[model samples]
Target: MAMRRTRILFMGLALLVLACGSTSGGGDDAMASGGSPGKALYNMNCTLCHGRDGKAGLNGAKDLTTSTLTKSEMVAIVQNGKGAMAAYKQLLTPKEIEAVVDHVRTLGRKK
Candidate 1:
């Protein structure tokens, strides 16, 4: 239970940072630009809820490591979100979304 609370608190703080950091002259973190962009983006934006390995399942997040969703299906879910997950359609570009989905697919293959 405490772990869940800690996760929630962390997510809240991350969101706070995102909100405060946004400005009219917006720019993404360097992680969004190059070198394992998917993993980097996921680390910064998703680990709190979906987790580094995509099994945290916090706030109704699904276990990506075990998800049966196809790439397109997962892309839709990420772009639109569900339940407590925030829609990334506005936050992430289409290519980044695809990259994240590709990374998610790898999670299911890990032993």
Candidate 2:
């Protein structure tokens, strides 16, 4: 039974490592971190320039309020980047990019 127990322990440790490795991908981080996917991602990545409330307006960061870009357009801009904006395609997954787009939509809301 000693060998059997060792094998089981090894398998459990392997599974634990695998789970921990994949957890950093943001699937669970999104839920546990609080805030929506976009809000979390934006806070981590975009808030420096765009501002926390989305209106600090640093370095000519275009007021998201005035942006004419639709959600899809905004996603493209984020993925591809504009004049001064750097593209985030490499830093974030497509799902994370979509989360940012959805979060931007909520800017300027009353609540």
Candidate 3:
């Protein structure tokens, strides 16, 4: 029974490590295609309304999956705010906003 318990603990630890290893860590992939900081930021600020996949539309949030807004357009909207959405200019830096825009672009590519 003790040996079985030890094996179970080892398996749990292995799973935990594997899970952590799979995370993106906000690297270049996140910057280029919404992997890390961009994904993290989106989750923190946009997910509540945009949904995990950017299609939730809670409180009139637009469906990012089908959005055709260009990067510059997205950046402007993010900085200036749309109808219901509040401007993020006060919250995120220019680089952060660009990262989020990059991330939002990835949402449309999801199958």
Candidate 4:
């Protein structure tokens, strides 16, 4: 009986180790289907002014949901600050900027 219990415990531990080592996918595995890669980045950086839905409009922040700016236009503004907004050029990479733009563009149509 003691040996059987030990074997069962060993098996459980083995399975747990295997599960821990396994993955469903690579980077961004938890991201939803069709979800933008920039969503997380936006949450970390832009959420303060833009909010989760991009409608916060706090502290001179524009309502991104109603924004009609082109992608290039938005990128330029993000890179170079506008009014109360701080320039992200010294902070985020160009790729990060593009990702943020992609995420922000989806805000208006989310509802």
Candidate 5:
């Protein structure tokens, strides 16, 4: 029992260390240099389901390239929740949401 307890304690300590040591996806300087905070946050939290390119098709994740919703509508959808999409009012700030809206708007601009 003592050995088991020691193992568990060690595991917990290791996990805590790793969590603290892990850096955000990019460097802090990068974020400060006009990096899109919304894009970074979205990439970290939403990309898996929404797709890295914003066209994941996961459970019909809407293609931002074709979304007709205005910025206000997008903000509403992000903050108030829409269909399967979760509300991010608490998770993201208005500034971050604007950044995300901007990034989403560029999905298919070249094509």
Candidate 6:
């Protein structure tokens, strides 16, 4: 009986480890879906000003959900800084900036 209980305990622990390993905080899913990295980056950097859905407009930040800017235009503004917004050029890599831009585009589609 003692050995059987120990085996069961080990099996339960192993199952828990497997479950944890297969789960993520969503960052991996976002990347796997081709936009999660951008979403993660946006949440980290833009959510405060743009709001979670990009319509917050705090501190004079634009309502990205309604903006009609193209990807290139958005990238330029993000890289160069616009009005009250600080430039990300000194802070983020080009790829990261692009990811952020991609994330912003999703905001416009959220309704």
RMSD per candidate (Å) reads 7.8, 13.3, 12.7, 15.5, 9.6, 14.8
Which scores higher on TM-score, 2 or 4? 4
lDDT of 1 by residue, 1-111 (tens): 995675566546645554554542235444333334566557767887999889999988899999987899999988998888877786678987898788778777855
lDDT of 2 by residue, 1-111 (tens): 995565356445544544554656655445433546566667656776788767877876888865777789999999998876767776667887898777877775534
lDDT of 4 by residue, 24-106 (tens): 33344245335455665576667778898899988889999999899999999989979988777766678878987988888
Candidate 6 on 2-110: residue-level lDDT in tens?
9556535644554453355356554444543553556656766777689988999999998998999999999999999899887777666798789889888877884
Q: Compose the digit string of candidate 3's lDDT tens values, residues 22-63.
A: 573534343444344566666666776899889999999999
How close to the true structure is residue 87 of candidate 5, measured as C-alpha lDDT? 69
| TM-score, one value per model | 0.67, 0.64, 0.68, 0.68, 0.63, 0.69
Candidate 5 Cα errors over 4 Å, as ranges: 1-34
**Highest TM-score against the true fold, candidate:** 6
- State the lDDT of candidate 5 residue by residue for 17-110, as single tens digits: 3344354444542633355555555555466557767777687678776778887898788777778776666656677677767766666464
- Which ten-residue region of model 3 has the weakest summed lDDT? 26-35
In candidate 6, position 69 carries an lDDT of: 91
lDDT (Cα) of model 1: 0.73
Ranking by TM-score: 6, 3, 4, 1, 2, 5
Number of clashes in model 5?
0
